[model samples]
Target: MLIGEVARRSGVSTRMLRHYDSLGLVRPTGRTVGGYREYSEEDIRRIFHVESLRSLGLSLRQISRALADPAFAPASLVGDLIRRTEERLKREQELLDRLRAVDASAPFDWRGVLRIVELLHGLGSPDAARRQQTVLTPAEDAPVPAEVLAEAVLAEADPYVAGALRWALARAGADGVASLAAGVRSEHAEIRRRAVRALAELPGDEATAALADALGDSDPAVHRHAALALGARGTTTAVPTLVRMIVEGTNDVEAAEVLGTLAADPERTDRLMSALAAELAAPTADSAVRIRLAQALAEMPATSAHGLLRQLAHDEDRAVAAIASALVRAAEQRPQG
Candidate 1:
């Protein structure tokens, strides 16, 4: 086959075939009387092989080495190709995401598009201060999309940056709730924890519902943050998690305060008091646990809590009795509401 016939059959252009020959990648096996390049069957097969390798993202140099160097191991080269392809895919996906975010923001002009692109880049910056500035600085002209903020809020690790991201998401409002909710279900424990904390800062029923759903998360930290948020929202579902937080002494003080808020509702007050009383009565409930429960009871104002406090005041455990007695005396001294 001649070069033209080879190009027509193998889908390799004549120009490329000549370039391949110049690089000594695939030289025609013979030439006709007119001195035109002629390709043998084996030469055409090598051309097809080079094309196939190029399709797999192999550079011309790599392909030449792969075809000619008997010592070149394919396994390592294939692994390298895989890694490079994956990196390229990651970059493309990030670009697609940025474009989608920009389009979703409905930028009015090139400047608007540039602003959002800048903000997105800033949010993903490795420098924590840069990420903070991305959230803190508000463009009166072009606002960053809420989805972008939500994504940052979920992935952020720096304490200060995370706080700023949460504030930005909250300011963005319900728009970021869906993203934050997805974060709540993330398999990563830290992500789930950060997600709920950010959700707690957001307003609206969506965020509240997400927090309520997070109350059942297996991570105690997740449950603590969700319960605190739900309790403040006056949701009864947070009662159990709030009580558990108190017993575990993890943010027990804030948990008790939120429980006190939840207890303001008459219907919920009994349930909250009963949960505390039951935990205190558990045989496995150690003295420290009992003392935390007694401290929590001081925050509850319901009549049921008063009765439980009275019972605890005379308990056999000296430390438990002392704390409970102090709570009761303090309650007695209060001018009855």
Candidate 2:
């Protein structure tokens, strides 16, 4: 077939076919009597193969190596193409995300768009201090989006920068809650921990609910932090977690103090006392555990804890007995409620 016929049938543009010849990807198998390029059936087949490889995102140079070198492994080249395509896709996605974030602000003009892009770049900067400044004192005219702050908060590892991100995120309000909440469920332990910690600072029912969900996290650190934050928020749901913390001797003192403050509630009095008294009676309550529980019990109101204190005052464990005795003595001097 002549070059024109091959171009028509194979859908390979004549210019591109000439370029392919220059690169030796596919050369015409013969020359016509008039000296025009002519392609044999095999040459046409090679042209189709080159087009097929190009469809797989193979570069012209790679296609040349693939078609000419039998020793060239398609598997390795395809793997490389897959990786490069994935990288390109990732960049495109990031760019699309930036544009969407800018659009989300409903920017008034080019300047507004520019402000958001600049803020995003600052947040994503390699310098932690630059990120901190971007969040800590964002331009007054260019409001930072909550999702942006939440993303930065989840990714920041610098202690100071992370603190700033959380502070900014809280100011952004409940809008950031969903993003932070997603971070709470992340499989990466560090991200999950940071997510919950940031969520803990954010006020709103959404953040509180997220913290409550985190109470069941498999990581002890995550659950403990969530429980402490929840306890501070006066969420009754945190009671069981705080009790567990005391028993495990992890931040037992703080847990005990929060529990003490919680027990001041008349409704929680009975449940709180019962929880401590049961732990004291548990066979698993070793001396150290018993001592921590005894100290926690002392935090309860004198009226609520008096009977439990009396029982522990003469306990077989001297340290436990001593803590109960000292608190009982102190309770005696106070006026009855």
Candidate 3:
């Protein structure tokens, strides 16, 4: 086959085949009488081999080395190709994400788009200060999209930056609720915790509802955070979880404080006290758990907790008895409302 025929059959252009000849990557096995390039069957096979390697993202130089050196091992080269491909994919994915974020912003014009783009760059900056500034620097007149801030909140690893992101999301109000709600179901506990914390700061019935739903999260820490946030919002659904935290000794003090706030309501006083008392009564309630329960009970309205405190003052555990006794004495000396 001649060069033209070879190019036509192999799908490689004649110009490219001449360039391959110049590089000695593939040479014609023979020439026509007019001295035009002629390709033999064996030469055509080599051209197909080169094309096959190129399909795997191999550079012409590397392919040359591969075809020329029988001793060359493909393991190292293939590994490099894999790494390069992964890096390219990562860059492409990031670009796609940025584009999606921009599109989601639905900016009014080129200026708003530029601001969001610039803000995204700052958020993605490697420096923690820059990321925080990105969240803070956006003027109130042009708020960054809530979804963008929500995504940053989930991804931020730096404590200060995460806090700033959360503050910003809170101001975004219900706009971020959908993005954050999706995050609540993340398989990752860290992400779920972040999402919950952000939801906690937001001021709206929607944010409150999202936090309430997170009470059923499988991760103890996730549900615990959600419980604390819900308690502050006076969502009674958090009651059982708050009591469980006291029993489990996870953030028991804060849990008790929130419970105390909840207990201030006349109707809920008896119910909240009962929940704590029930935990104290549970067979699994260990000495430490009872002590936590006793401490939590003390945070309630003194009248509500006074009876339980009196009973616990003489309990079997010395530590529980001492603490409860002190609380009982204090309750006794308290002024009447």
Question: TM-scores of all models?
Answer: 0.93, 0.91, 0.93
TM-score of 1: 0.93
Model 3 spans > 4 angstroms off: 139-141
Query: Over 4 Å off in model 2, which ranges?
Result: 323-337
Which of the numbered candidates is closest to the native, going by highest lDDT?
Answer: 3
lDDT of 1 at 99: 88
Compared with the true structure, what per-residue lDDT tens digits does model 3 show for residues 210-308? 898799999898899999999998989999999988888889999999999999899899889888888878999888998888889878999788888
Residue 184 in model 2: lDDT? 90
lDDT of 2 by residue, 159-218 (tens): 999999888888878898888999999999899899999988988888999999899999
Model-by-model lDDT, in order? 0.88, 0.88, 0.89
Query: Which stretches of model 1 miss by more than 4 angstroms?
Result: none
Q: Write the per-residue lDDT of candidate 1 for residues 1-337, one digit (tens) a residue.
A: 8888888998889899889989999999888999877898899889889999999989999999998888888999899999998999999998998888999999889999888888889887889988898789968898888988888878888999999888877787789888889999999999999999998888889899899889889998898888888889888888888888888889989989998888877888888888998898788789899989988988888465789888888989999999999999898888776
Which candidate has the highest TM-score of all? 1
Q: Per-prediction RMSD in angstroms?
A: 1.8, 2.3, 1.9
